[model samples]
Target: MNDPQFNPETDLNFDPDGVPTEPAPAPEPTPPLPEAPHPVATGRVNTGRFEPVRQLYQRICSEVSKVYVGQEELVLSTLVALFSGGHVLIESVPGLGKTLFVRTLGKTLGTKFGRIQFTADLMPSDITGAPIFNMKTQEFTFRPGPVFTQILLADEINRSPAKTHAALLEIMQERRVTVERTTHQLEPPFLVMATQNPIESEGTYNLPEAQLDRFMFKVMVEYPTAMEEVRVLKEHSGQVAVEQRLEDEVATVTGPEQIMKAIQLCSQVLVADELFDYINNIVRQTRSWPQFHIGASPRAGIALVQGARTLAAFNGRDYAIPDDVGEIVLPALRHRVVLTAEAEVEGHQVDEALRNMIRTVEVPRM
Candidate 1:
């Protein structure tokens, strides 16, 4: 009533409650830009924090190359199995540098290396050690054999009797040895690289399926190419030169601690759901496929995935692709499955049948 023209609408700077009386602003519209893809969704996982993995991978290959000539695939496969925390089986004739390759790997990794020459007369006690009475202390002492080392090369493993071969099954799977009712644990980074002669079967015993399943990979070492042969001949002209070269040229690039670190890093590699489906399809086909009498076990699928992760790390990728699985599946399952009599009569090989399975499986769209 102070001013007749003072209308509430025009003088509405203050409300009855003394709160500001401005009209609410319009809501901002969200931008309509396209959504960004998730790291895993895009198929390329991030390696932002794992620089050491790629660095160590390159360093190891470079160091192993100095003394060990070409066989890049062999070296890579072995390294994959190593970082995967699994054992390797190398099959070839005598004197193809199988022993040298293993020895060089041991030296390169700077681990405690031991060699056991498997023979028909070899006993489990010889490999896992036996308890002996200590004359000085008048007490029983447990002495560890070659199995106590970080890397054990079981040379000519097939020459050993079944009983001796069975000794490794427990230790390989459990990473521990039980002796005289006492269990001893193997140190981390333990690996066994066993070699066998493929040409000779007269005295060799067939590795049982249980023992075969324990191996992560059964690599078939073939004859060197003409160029590679020439290089080997030039490098190993004399035994003394070879030994000196291995000692001087092949430097220790790393140790067990670094290896364990790499193994841990490998476990972090990203694998998408689609890739898992692909692995499942491939493994499932093995069971139903007519070519195989005994198909790959579930463990084989897991091994493939683990090895693929390591391979992905080696290639400096944070995510595993279908190619990585394809590259490692053969080695992972070659020893795990057996061909049917019909397939064998038709001259089908395990690797060939596995390849066919892969080709038949549908690859997920990236």
Candidate 2:
């Protein structure tokens, strides 16, 4: 080998001269971390297949807010039930916009709206039409009742007797009416929103367990905040009536077909195997929880799953998250479970007990 060159300016490739330092190996590149799905409200998650659902939700809320000043959760619960193809039983004082909300919902949905003011005298035949003998035809003709509408408001439902209440059980569950052994099927996207007063017990009958079970959610309406009440006053102080305002301000966003399509999307929302366990765990936990005497039936679990799916879609997700289930569990199981006399005596509300029980259930990462 030749003598090593040591000149300052000499190329380093020669002997003794740095042989390029073996081309100093580059440090191994770090692999990228997998991306996580963020909270849906943050606008980080891709809307993907459920974008329409989210958009529809926003539009309806926007239009509804113009007239109905507050009670956001009430609106959301109704929407959840609506998308899940289930009924809602609301408990609120009068003049809190329950009727106004339902009317606005029916307007935005572009569906027919009907209201039945339940009284002690209200009969089954009054809600479900009975066959009337026609003199012209010389035969009986079946006349459909208010129940035939796509969106029905059963106002003050508890005022009606059990027999009248029984009429709704079949209509709610089957979306049809059977009169004279002839079945008349209701159109698609039928929604029944029944409201009862918690303050009135003298004239109100307690809802049967079976009837209560039919409702996917039992929403309790709270008084609006000061700002909300001010807005309500400002909006309603005008000479225009609520119906006039709803007609002038609220715009129709969709029809029954679109609503049915959204319902289908909610039905297709992805649920992990673990999520099934999580929901089962929650529902089953309610059965044995020390606070509850009567737990939710299997229908409650079904309602939870369906409600969660609809909520997930509302958040612009095609797949449900545990948080979605958490938000939905309250309304889904609150009415289904019964607190024990001890717990009730302890001044415990069924809602509070349900939330506490849910915290004990393990959440799935999915």
Candidate 3:
């Protein structure tokens, strides 16, 4: 009623006593968007990219042969487990190059490697990091252990007590260690290659079935052939001579980033739905079978698939075939399944059961 025509912009004014109000500052100018990450370009030819992975494998084998003489199968299986992002359990007698193979592989790949010589009195905190008091910050800081590396060689893993073995299960499964109410994530491409001496069981504690199941492959390294043994002797004639020989011959074949890229490519390998169903059927049969006291866990199924993918890549293929699944059957499932008392008494091996299961399962036609 005071003003019939309202013109707020022009008529409204601040009195001397009235509160002064400033016009809202112009909205800040919007910033430019960040550029997208560069995309890797594919070539015109689809000449299998897995060729690089195969080359890397061959390089690893060659490097390992520099230190280890025989057990080509063991080396290949260990590489397959690594490609699958899984750990391995090498069960063999002493002086079988199990430790050397792991160490050499670490050298060839140019990855951070650590070895933990397990003893009967080893503690859990010895493997997983432990918290320590810090005087500077007046707080406890986690001191990482040997497990925080690209490749961890658990030498004589069975010599450790059950509790020590159990400590690694969580690290292998979750890829993290919890200390002082804080969890530390392990670096990518983390792998644990654990070796156990089969002949010396006097003081060693048998790895619990639960701990055994964490390993993707249980490789049995046997004595080399006469020819391979000859090669070993020729290569290691004398400590000084062998040291001189490897001075300039060895070189890093691949980096951690390339290895990770190859692993990601393995995930892209095609697996038909029928093949998946076949795998499921085989896993289900293990559960229903009467010969087994405990069937393979879900982890076994995953291991089977991952192992097959790596095998396919090893064969320079971009797709998984039935033969791939059949090839890795024993190593992936042997440690996971437990036999019944009768099966054990009858000397029925898990490998034999796995072979039978593979034969019973139908192969999906491409």
lDDT of 3 by residue, 1-366 (tens): 012222223221223332113221222233322221111222122234554454556656776676767787688778888899998998888877665666677777878888999998999999897989999999988899989998988999989888898889889999998887789999979988888887788889989988888899998888889998888777766666433444455556677776776677677666668768878888888887778888988888888888888877666556676778877788888888889999999999888877886677777655
Best-to-worst order by lDDT is 2, 1, 3
Would you give me the overall lDDT of model 2?
A: 0.80
Measure candidate 3: CA RMSD: 18.7
Off by over 4 Å in 2: 1-47
Full candidate order by TM-score, most accurate first: 2, 1, 3
- Candidate 3, residue 125: the lDDT equals 97
Model 2 residue pairs with clashes: none
Q: Candidate 1: give the clashing pairs.
A: none
**With candidate 3 superimposed using the best TM-score fit, by how many Å does residue 39's alpha carbon deviate from the native?**
28
Regions of candidate 3 where Cα sits further than 4 Å from its true position = 1-47, 134-139, 241-247
User: What lDDT score belongs to each candidate, Candidate 1 first?
Assistant: 0.78, 0.80, 0.74
- Residue pairs clashing, model 3: none
Writing each residue's lDDT as its tens digit, candidate 1 over 1-366 gives: 012222222222323332224432222333422322345668565533343455556666777776677776678778888899899998888767866787788887888888999998999999999999999999999999889998888999999989998999989999999998999999989888888887889988999998998898989888888998898888777666555776888767677876776687678788889988888888888888888898888888888889878877666566777888878888888898889999999989888998887788898765
Give the TM-scores of the predictions, in the order they appear: 0.86, 0.87, 0.82
